[model samples]
Target: RSYPTTTDEEDPDSNLNATCPEYFRWIHEDLRPWAYTGITLDMVERAKATANFRLVVLNGTAYLEQYQKAFQTRDVFTLWGILQLLRKYPGKLPDLDLMFDCVDWPVIKSIDYGGPNATTPPPLFRYCKDNETLDIVFPDWSFWGWPEIRVKSWVPLLNDLMEGNQRMGWDEREPHAYWKGNPEVAETRQDLLKCNVSDQQDWGARVFAQDWKKESKAGYKTSNLADQCVHRFKIYVEGSAWSVSEKYILACDSVTLLVQPRYFDFFTRSLKPLQHYWPIKPNDKCRSIKHAVDWGNTHQQE
Candidate 1:
């Protein structure tokens, strides 16, 4: 399969150096464990218990050693992305062997490997990691596409969100905060759902449980990411781990009520709370969400 490549003629500014995102600095720290020792085959093997697959790139060709089938098609698309990179940049990529875990949580805790008897940390790539783990974060498979859930690739979906934002300006949206996702995956989310309006209280939050089975039967019309941009504020609460819903909510042009997350993905480190999102306390979710919506409503210009 052929992939698109940029031409200098197509964009004269292609040669200009652009500032890298702040998170790029963390690459050094992420690779620190292996900087002196270097990653060995034994280190790669150590990660197999938690890794779904082992990938090797040698001489512009790719090989995979699957330990097990990843949940849904996560491993499928992840390997597809690597193959595309090989095609996109021919001989630029180095020969390397790596372990990739498709699961939500990072398993290699840094605390486990930090003592006099500590062994060199095995390098493991995964979707998200907490500050306590040494797992290297990579972009999740949802970026390319999440066909099982009907979420399109990042670029096209982002285009749809931009169009959605234009359709309903921020001032024209509903005044309450909005969030829609499965609450069954995490108790934190179940707690968040309690913030939704009820007969006894209206927390200024409109949270909805996403019944994927029901939505699948109905062709996901109600769950369309673009259509979710009707609220002035959007809420982002972590499910099992760091969620893939983050970029979608932030792109909605609504004030994002970000519930404090324990884990983070590849790019979220660059996001600043007050500038990019309004922080919501996970423990006191109802009150925090209420305050965010109210504050955004009051500070319309900001």
Candidate 2:
């Protein structure tokens, strides 16, 4: 478990802190003959080899907005999720690429938005032109299109919300939450509506509604869950689950999503909805989400 140490007795922590800036400045600053030492042909070869799992990191809200699951824009914490995956598979994954929409670039790089802090554009995106290049399929990254009304971060707090719902005398014994995609989008919204939810109380639990469609730029009312007496979520997401990635947004929030695990690999997490991995259809030519998750997780544990 231990790594080899250098006998040079300089304080490792302080030395690293002191030298890293110099090293970075030397690499980034101009007027250097050998500035490209870190990058080489072997790295390129390795990166190409890793292209099988192309990792596309978004610079900010804009890149994700393209897919229609605007929920991806809210929090910066999701970046750590990518780092965790990379740590799990160091060499197997292609080098992470950074990309942002042409419009958001200025705002992201602007000084007012903590231009120098982590919010600033990631350097890797600048170097690597390939981003949002991963072909993997993933949907339902969260419960609702909106992260704010989605799953509470802490598990205990989540239980509280559920308990509160129960205390309100709304089917405390068997409570159910429903997650629906865009009314217009296919594979998610339309199919979500297909699932029968007519009964007020189905399977002994009260049925709740979840929508993942986003509010139009023209502005739309937030989730009407507050107005409703029932305990449900207001997820405003729309578009193709495979194409738009709203389904994975639902999965990210520990919501019990309803979907035929079509493209779950790219966003599979601990808390996911109904998974229909392989056998995606009667003519299913799909792989098992459980298998892929296990495979990825096995490598991570190893």
Candidate 3:
């Protein structure tokens, strides 16, 4: 998480020589549509329908034009994330204004803007987007911390998970694939719970329902993200549009049983199906999950 900084004493070019990561290509891809016709104020105004707020960054200072309040502290943390970016790279970001929506589903459908007589696509920033959408994707607010859930920031939480992983070798971990999250938010997640071990069937998966209210009452001991790496495989399924649990599931030092996702975040485009995770079929979720776990149980070296 440490960033390389250039001081007046050192040549700025020294740090510039390092190549940008490949995942940065997505940023270019997101903005490519507007590259030809630049973002106009009119285009910005067009996005107001779905935007929770308009963020204007001019001369290193930021201003917010709130249209509607987002759920909980989403807008607050989202703006905080932007301010952190402005602070991390001072005097580097250009003067710009953009619309931000904190909703789960992306609204700017490609079908709407792809017709021959269609108007220019309005630029919008959101948490996640599908391939059929034109919305620019950004990292979720949980990157800073999910305070309500008592989850720490990304770097420290990742360090804690790594330490937890070291305590138990992958081979020594539980043979069953594991998943624990709220199933009520999406039917897909509710369907996943059916794959769990039962008297009639054992799907090689262990799934638990996350009771945030109960967890909060218990001081979040059983719900700690760092302590959930006890299994050799972990499941990640999208809730609503996309869940913020993808990174955490991948960080567990275990094979990931990733349910096929319709929406993607800023960095998930770089993940390969078989290379990064075992893709679980949405239609045949139970059987697909069982197959992935069985494959992992047999192919331990992979």
Candidate 4:
């Protein structure tokens, strides 16, 4: 969806302000505390003038005209993704230059341990309010707000499964824990795969290796979200730093066996242990996961 060129007075129900009115209001009101503090009307105006693009801010709403021209060829996906997010809430999204960065292994490989950009940026958005110079303050795509293509497709199905799981009582699900994702990105995931039930130690976790390329070839219809929620417990192990799958895992009614994460997203820190999810040790992942699964299965009433 594209932003309207007409003024707010010219068209009260502009294309950007029409759909998701409540969502827009929530963004304007709720997200005000988290908005970039450095961005002023003068800065916005100067950015618009210098870039030779029209960015209209009317009634706390920002309308970027020729937004595509400001971005480079490499940033197309990031720009499109951010625009899709803005389109979701319309005029409610704040007027700021949202920076994007990859948080996976590729980004990690580029950084030197004791180098300049190493300790500070961390290849992901920093959550602190004091860091005003850093315009990269928005939450990752993993959280609820952003509208990426993969997220847009899977979230609905996941929500449906969540609703279905709620209807089908917790006791009905299988006694074992479940987790499925690609293990190539992080050694933590590889370690998780190794924790699967074997003669050495019974982890009581049904772990599956996800082949994205193979799944894409098969049209991704084989991996049903509802089928995944059939277990009494769900394990959440991060891929690289943070995985979008965390939210999906927590959405299920089953007990969430969360492995200690290296990085925390916008909302992850807010989640309480033994309440929202059962936390497992990062050091002894195999043993911790096995213990958590066993305890949860034994205390089904809890």
Candidate 5:
């Protein structure tokens, strides 16, 4: 929330020298081109301080200290991703200042269904929870779509799969509603599994329960992202809070049968109902899913 301005007396060249424009461009050029504005040595320091505070408060001082050490060594996954991008771009990295006036860090107010207290304080930045408050909004990190941080385990794989699906085209895909993920994360996932009986018995959806522990033992090769896209419909159910799988599900050419989500990610508000996805009511999940699957199956060409 603090917006401090750089003093005019400060040497512009010194500020420029302190910034790694190559690093900035590498991390943000493709995802956020506008991030290159107003970036300075001072801004970077401020952002770092804010980020460190957030980490310390939320993830404990040890985590914050670890990140600080990583930043110092330039050996963190986020920094590594930036370095890779810089290497990929080589001389093409831009010299623009992309740091923003305000930091857009994400904060979660509450994950439960009852909703957050009305008297809750303003979020430090964008907030995520079951419902949106004044300063609380933006979906969870699963849908944040920032690949540089390596925050979530599935992100890098999901990113590659989405890109691969884009290249493969939609004509080759089938018409079944497909969903694959661990069902143990939430009761909603268990409800989703209930709808996956027989085509005649329930929703004609194909739901596969993914045991991550077993999958990890098998090196995760069994779960193919491109293969999941073969279906024309994909179901997105929230696990505990808001599911990160929502982004991946929507990224596919397949229409997403989104179960009424309790939480929203940073980009969820931008998506319109019946436009980007078909909403399935949580109370009538089975019936709603069946209806959506039937509708999507009938209107495949649309």
Candidate 6:
């Protein structure tokens, strides 16, 4: 398989077209070689290889044009782009494993990805018929149909447990951030919101996040800014996570938010949900995923 840099023309064999910093933080450093550092046409061509199996990290559809600031945002064409590669190259791999955290159907439709009737793809299910294995992983948009996509969605409180552990370490009672991803975000935020630290001296002591990667292209323009923010004051995460797989990186980085019963599950071995971010309620069942507030109720339990 050929791995081309930026020089190669756009094709299925290419990868690393765009990346976010969190992409690197979650996995072990040793797997770096497995990643295609940049997007190139040759990389897509490489995907055509008839291997026993092919693991597609992202949708391989080719972009008609170049994407800028790929690190901080999402471009709809990504998933279809990868699928285009698979169809064009026809990998020797018998079965392909595709992973998605949420059911982003709009993106799928944007790529013209479904239906045996459509001109582009012959319905992902039909395309996989020839292959030995066809694996698809994502939260089932609905609880009905497609067994692989089925998931038992739950809100877990784990980060709080980890912070408690950290506290114990200081007291010579528990492990020191033994839960390396132990959180400070929830604990800190709740403290300020509840205590209403009316102290004017501590006003700027709280921040959201730094825009170090705001406009940069390289490695999502990584900076110590986020970490720097954590060091300076209490931080708040303003949005909901894009994917389930992405939580590990956010939790691993800092303990910016304060804690709660819901966020407490963040330490669960089975769930280990993301750290206390914007909203405090994890167990608060959402009326709809889309309508779900990022997070609310900064007041902590006494």
What lDDT tens digits, residue by residue, belong to model 4 across residues 98-133? 223332312322233336454322222222112122
- Model 1 lDDT on a 0 to 1 scale: 0.88
Clash counts for all predictions: 0, 29, 0, 0, 11, 45
| Model 5: worst 10 consecutive residues (lDDT sum) | 54-63
Clashes of 3: 0
Is candidate 3 or 5 superior in lDDT? 3
Pick the winner on TM-score between candidates 2 and 6: 2
Q: Each prediction's Cα lDDT score?
A: 0.88, 0.31, 0.88, 0.59, 0.54, 0.27
How much RMSD separates candidate 6 from the native structure?
17.1
Is candidate 1 or 2 superior in lDDT?
1
lDDT of 2 by residue, 64-182 (tens): 21222223443233433444444444343444343222111111122322333522122212111111222212222232133454433334434554544454443222233334334
Off by over 4 Å in 5: 1-122, 125-127, 132-159, 166-172, 199-202
State candidate 6's TM-score.
0.26
TM-score for each candidate, following the candidate numbering: 0.94, 0.31, 0.93, 0.64, 0.57, 0.26
What 10-residue stretch in candidate 1 is worst by lDDT?
4-13
> Model 5 scores what on Cα lDDT?
0.54
Higher-TM-score candidate among 1 and 5? 1
Question: Where does the lowest 10-residue lDDT sum fall in candidate 3?
Answer: 1-10
Better of 5 and 6 by lDDT: 5
